[model samples]
Target chain A: MVIAAIGIAAAAALWRRDGAPAVGAALYHAWELFLFIAPSLLAGLLLAAALRQLVSPGALARWMGAESGWFGLAVATLAGALTPGGPMAAFPLVLVLAGAGADRGALVAYILSWALNGFQKLLVYEMPLLGPDFAIMRTLVTLPMPMIAGYIARRLPIAWEPPK
Target chain B: MTGGQVFLAVIALVAFGFCLRRGPGSARRAVVDTGQGLWKILPIFAVALPMAAFLAELIPADAAVAWIGPESGVSGVVVASFAGGLMPGGPFVTFPLVLAFAKAGAGVPQMAALITGWSIFALHRIITWEYPILGWRFVAIRLIAAAPLPIVAGLLAEAVVAVLPIGLGRP
Candidate 1:
């Protein structure tokens, strides 16, 4: 809602500043982007949905249920990148992992991995919007982050309790 | 369509085939899920693209370059990372805004830092999603552990761009 309002305001401002022609040009460019991106966006979403079905929550819990060491962290990170969708899809899996006895480090890795470079976001947004070069570079740079953070998180004195 | 688009379509098809093996029911569900997801986000896309375009127009390219261009270096990356953490909303909102910044001449490394910051430690997500569900103890540890990631990612991206023979940071 707020985003819509802000967008409207921006459009209005642009119109006022440079008249209809500038606004028209902006719209034209936006339209062009939309056209160029629409096919990939639809394919990416379909791919995400299909992949989600393939990796069921129960399977995910079983895979990460045990092991709190570096291997566990690596698996957790891979799972996070593979898990599709936004927070609504990913966070519940975190809950499931916690419930299934995944450690704090693994959980942290999962969240960080998803947040940083979840395949769904990469395919749907980054690749189409920023191009493959940018996406691949960003992914490579941040790829090690989840494990590194998870390793540190594992050493923390904090205790873990699954959310009720 | 570009090679990327073709690649995406081929992957989607292969995945759909796998889902079909699971059962026609599962295959249908995947399509239904995609439809629903598209319905939800299409409006955001419509708004975001125009908003990005207008904002790109509104913010002068010279200012963007001065603040986050290739010449701006580590300090610029640090500033971008901080700004990224403060950005609100989801991918729909953030990615379009990033695109706008890119169009306005933000550097690749700076944009990388911005995205890493947004992903790693988005304050809004932590408040709305993490703190409430995961509790403060978990949040504290996670934040401390991940704190340096954005800047690190930025610097790493810069180094990669420098080292690679291919032009890796153009976007």
Candidate 2:
């Protein structure tokens, strides 16, 4: 609602300066963009939804908690990439997995992977808005990041003794 | 439609089919989830897409280039990374804002850094969820561990752009 209001105000300001035509031009461009992205957007949402249903959070958490070392990080990274929804979904699962004895390094890897490589975010938002080329390039660069970060976290001297 | 778009569609269909094979209830749930997601995003898209268009016009190309263009190099990536961390809202807001920056001629590496920063730093998420549920120790370690990623991603993007013929065209 706030964003829409701000957009309207901006449009009105543009209209006053550029005479209605500028606002019209912006609208036209927006509509063109909408048409361009609509198909992919729908498809992406479907993919996200299907993926979410296919993989249960319980199974994922169990998988993460059971692994350790480099392989654990890899599994956590994969789980993070596969996890669906936003913070609400991912964070709770993270908490559960952590409480269930998931490795600290693996958890870091999981969070990083969720942030950087989650297919839901990539497909539903990134590819549609940023285009596939940029998305692909970014994804390629990001693929190795979670494991690297997780490995570093494991080496970090600071211990995570959970609040009692 | 672009190949990317077609590829997305095919994947979506296959995934949906897989869910259906698993059970009708799961397929129904997927459909419901998709509808809910659409409902959530549509209004935001209505405003954001146009906002991106106007922003493309309003943002000075020279400023964008000076701040985060290909010529701006490592410093540009650093600046973009911080800016991205500060950007409020979810993917719906962030991606459109990135689109505006891209249209205004921001560098590919800079944008890559920006997105990475947004994803990892995620101050809002950390404060809201991570701190409360995971405790301060966990948050600190996560932040420290992931600190270098955005810069790395930016440099990697720059290298890729140099090697590849393909470009990140303005959407």
Candidate 3:
């Protein structure tokens, strides 16, 4: 609501300066882009929600627990990529993993993987606007990043202070 | 639309069918979840997309190129990475702005850095989601571990662009 209001104000200001035609053109382009994106967004959200429901937290913990090692990190990364929704879905799962005794390394890998290479976001948003080449290149380049970060986090003795 | 779009559609369909086979209840729940997600995202789209278009209109192509285009070099990537982290909003907002930047002549490496920074270091997400849920210690460690990523990714992307043919950078 706030963002929309600010946008409206900005558009009105732009309209005053650039006149009606330019603003109209901009709006038309936005609508066109929206039309192209809506289906994919709907589809991606559906898939993400279904997957979220299907993958139980207990199962996630078992796969990514402290003793699970390198395989755990790999599984966590893959799961992070596949697990859908935004931070609301993700952070909760992180909490669940933490509570269920998942390894810190696996947790770090999971979050980083989701942040960098969320498959659903790529499918729905990135591929459409940025083109497949950019998307593919970005994906390939960032693929190993989470594991690298995970290993570093694992090696570092950063104190895990519990939340208030 | 594009091959990627078609591929995603097919994947969504398969997933939908699988959800249905699991049970009618699960399918219905998924649909409900989708609706809620759409509700949350649509307003951000409404604001961000038009704003992106407006930004493209306001910022001249030459200025965009000079600042973040192919010749802008490492500094451009650094600027883009920081700008991306500072950008507030989700994928619906950020990706459209990225498209706007691309249209206005930002380079592939810059865009790569932008996305990388947005994913890992977005301050808004860190304050709201990461800190509250995961605690400060976890957030700090993750930030330190991930700090070099965007710069590294940007440099690697630059190297790739140098090796590839002319049009490969755009599409």
Candidate 4:
């Protein structure tokens, strides 16, 4: 609602001089971007749906464990890889997973990866925003972020459960 | 089937799956219920799609590039990542500004770093959305946990490009 109001203000400001055309132009531009990512977003929705049904959070946490010592971090990174939303989108899910007994390290990892390095974020958002080489390189660089996040969470004072 | 056809089929299947999940109702009732849920959101999507396009058009790409492009280097990456912390809006809002940067001579590494930073490091979002809902301790821990990840992402990308053979110029 607040966001819509702001958009209306912007559109209205632009409208003072020429209302009809400004809205049309803005609408057209929005359409183009939507057209670009709709396929990917729809697919992301489907995959999310699949995940909701197919895997329990505990099972997801367990499968994500790659190294015995670094298990939490690895699992988090893997979780990060598949998750498709930006940070805001990823956080609640991270909390839910943690609530369900996912390791804190993994939760941090998943959160980092959820926005910075997910397959969907990379493929859909990054590729277009930064171009292929840029997107590809960034993904490569950030690959360790979630793992490192997990590692730090494991070592640091942060608690896995929400701070009461 | 072609990927397109397969995708269409999947869409249909998802709808059917949704119907199955709805329970012992008539097929007509199930379809109506499902349609109503979907119908509610369609107009909002219809409106948002273009507004983003205008924002994309309004923001000048060259300026964004100048501020956070490859020329900025590691410091640039750190700045970009943290600066990204203050932005509001979705990936849709975020990507266009960064895309503008990439088009204007930003390095691949830096470009990647900035985008990653922008998406995840948003503090406004953390405080506004996550904190209020989750509480002080949870929010603080989450934010504290958040800081180092983008840096790690930047450094890791650098290391991978250095150690692994990751370029495309054949001998």
Candidate 5:
């Protein structure tokens, strides 16, 4: 937060030096973007929270545990993609899954899926800003990443353990 | 409102309804969580949107085209990927910058690479969120395992564009 504040302050100073009109333009653009995204952001958070309540850790673990194999990876990937919120919402659920005995591979896959192709972000932000074509193309290109990464993580010689 | 916003609103309404049916406690929890998430995200947006506006105003379309435009090719993708990792903030900030760059004439492949790199190697996310929550070992392994992804995706996107240029819908 502090860093963001400092950045804004610095940018404001730079824009002010550039011209009063520039400052006004920048502020106007920011306000417009905020208004555009505010509803989606709020809805996304609510959806994420609701999901957290709906899906139990036991179910998450069962669906994405070590013994669940490729199916587990698929489930993890889908769950990660479907999850609606940011890292704060996703990571705690991950921690819970880890505690409930999800494998290292599943965990890694879950994180990668969320990072690369989170459905909520794609729908709310990416598609909206970048256009549906760009969003779809990117999604197609990235579809395999989480699974590939998960497979590699599973096969790596390193002794991978769940985060303590 | 955009189609995406309408879609999100529907999802939110359904989720809220479900939570409400589950219990008042659940609905309250959702509200509290939403508040916290908003708090975390707004500051980043506050800074990033202005930065994007500034970039949009300052950078020329031709310069952006020369650097990360289609003619710039693989090198442009590499540079974009690196920039994406270094960029701080969440999607609210990152997407607008990409939009700015696109409007300034960045190629689709470069944009793809940028988004990929931002997703995987964002230093802010790695340091502030992933490490603290998942621990160093997991983070390291995941980083190493996924290192080649953005570049590969970028290259593939470039190839796809060459074969079926219309499919990518390049700006």
Candidate 6:
């Protein structure tokens, strides 16, 4: 609210100063941001649904339920790969991961990484859009983020009790 | 599309259901009937493409960088995150938006951060789609957890670039 108010105020001020209309750069930016985000959401939803139907959750949990370690991290990442989309992408997978015995911390790890990248999304959307170089570079760097995320989730200091 | 391939997809899906099956599988039955294959899912993506195109018309690339670029790191991170969170659509246009920032002298940090912001952190989707289905608790958890993803993704991406075998150094 504060930022928007300031933005509007700045635009108003500028409009008053110059002979132009009150529309300003901030408003334009706000508009741009909105336009840019729409299509992918649609695509992600489509893919997410496909994923849910493809993989069964209980089996996925068994796979992901490997002993917690770096090995655990690999399992989570691979589970994420086999699973499609993020939390809201598909219903069954996310629910299965949550309900079918995937630990909360590991689920978080999977989700954070899963939500970010995967085969279909990267192969079709990102790698093509950003190009192979960008995709590969991003993959190399992000490979570690999930591990870090998974590690942090396991070592969580925050006191939220795990759901029974 | 071929009969054999359809046979394979079906076989794979059935195998998947039998092995890892949980949640709605017994009820839903089979791979072709799985979550992604439903007819109900295409509307959002179609809607998103036009909306994004219309939006980009308003905010040019130079301007986005000015507001969310790395010159102001903390503010940059926050703004980029929110911008991403606020959108109701796809990263298709956001990709160009990131490029726009980079073209306008935005740092790799800002571009990467903006991309992170754009991913799954969207606010409109959360409100309309996720909230009703999952409730506020999960929604809130996702939002709070995703808050810094953009910054972290950006910083780490930069770290990778700096140390790439090709290296980021001048020739």
| Model 6 C-alpha lDDT per residue in residues B42-96, reported as the tens digit of each score | 3432333233233333345566556765455656656665666554444444554
Candidate 1 ranges beyond 4 A from true positions: A62-67, B163-171
- Angstrom error of the Cα, residue B1, model 4: value is 17
**TM-score order of candidates, best first?**
2, 1, 3, 5, 4, 6
Superposed model 6: Cα runs more than 4 Å off: A1-58, A85-89, A154-164, B1-61, B69-78, B96-106, B128-146, B162-171
- What are the runs in model 2 whose C-alpha is more than 4 Å off? A63-67, B169-171
Candidate 3 CAPRI classification by DockQ? medium
Docking class of 6: incorrect
Q: Candidate 1 lDDT, tens digit per residue, B46-157?
A: 8888888888888887778988887799998999999999998888888888888887878889999999999988899889889888999999999989999999999999
Q: Write the per-residue lDDT of candidate 4 for residues B23-112, one digit (tens) a residue.
A: 535334545543453454345555444444444444555655566554566776677667666667766556654543444444444545
Candidate 5: tens digits of C-alpha lDDT, residues A1-164: 54465446646675767877876776787677667667666766666666666654336567777778788888888777876668888888888888887888888888889989987677556764565567777888988888888878887767756666
lDDT of 3 at A65: 71
Candidate 5 deviant stretches above 4 angstroms: A1-18, A35-46, A49-53, A56-58, A82-95, A119-137, B20-44, B127-137, B155-171
Can you list each candidate's DockQ? 0.64, 0.68, 0.55, 0.26, 0.45, 0.12
Instruction: Name model 3 segments beyond 4 Å from true.
Output: A161-164, B159-171
Per-residue lDDT over B1-171 for candidate 5, one digit per residue giving the tens place of the 0 to 100 score:
655456666877797889899999988987887778668767766776677666666667677898789878989989888888898877877887787787688888999999999998989988988888777888888888898888888898888778765222123
Expressed as tens digits, the lDDT of each residue in B55-161 for candidate 2 is: 77677776699899988999999999889888877887788888888878789999999999999998888889889988888888998999988998998898898
Top candidate, metric TM-score: 2
Task: For residue B147, give model 4's deviation from the true position in Å.
Answer: 2.3
TM-score of 2: 0.93
Interface RMSD of 4: 7.3
As a whole number from 0 to 100, the lDDT of residue B167 in candidate 2 is 49
> For this target, which candidate reaches the highest DockQ against the unseen true structure?
2
lDDT of 1 by residue, A14-114 (tens): 99999999999999988888887788789888988898788854355555543657788888888889988778888877888888878788888999999
Name the lDDT value of residue A50 in candidate 4: 40
lDDT of 2 at A144: 83
Compare candidates 2 and 6 on lDDT and give the better one.
2
Write out the backbone clash pairs for model 5: none
For model 1, what is the alpha-carbon lDDT of residue B110?
A: 92
What C-alpha lDDT, on a 0 to 100 scale, does residue B67 get in candidate 3? Answer: 81
Clashing pairs in 3: none
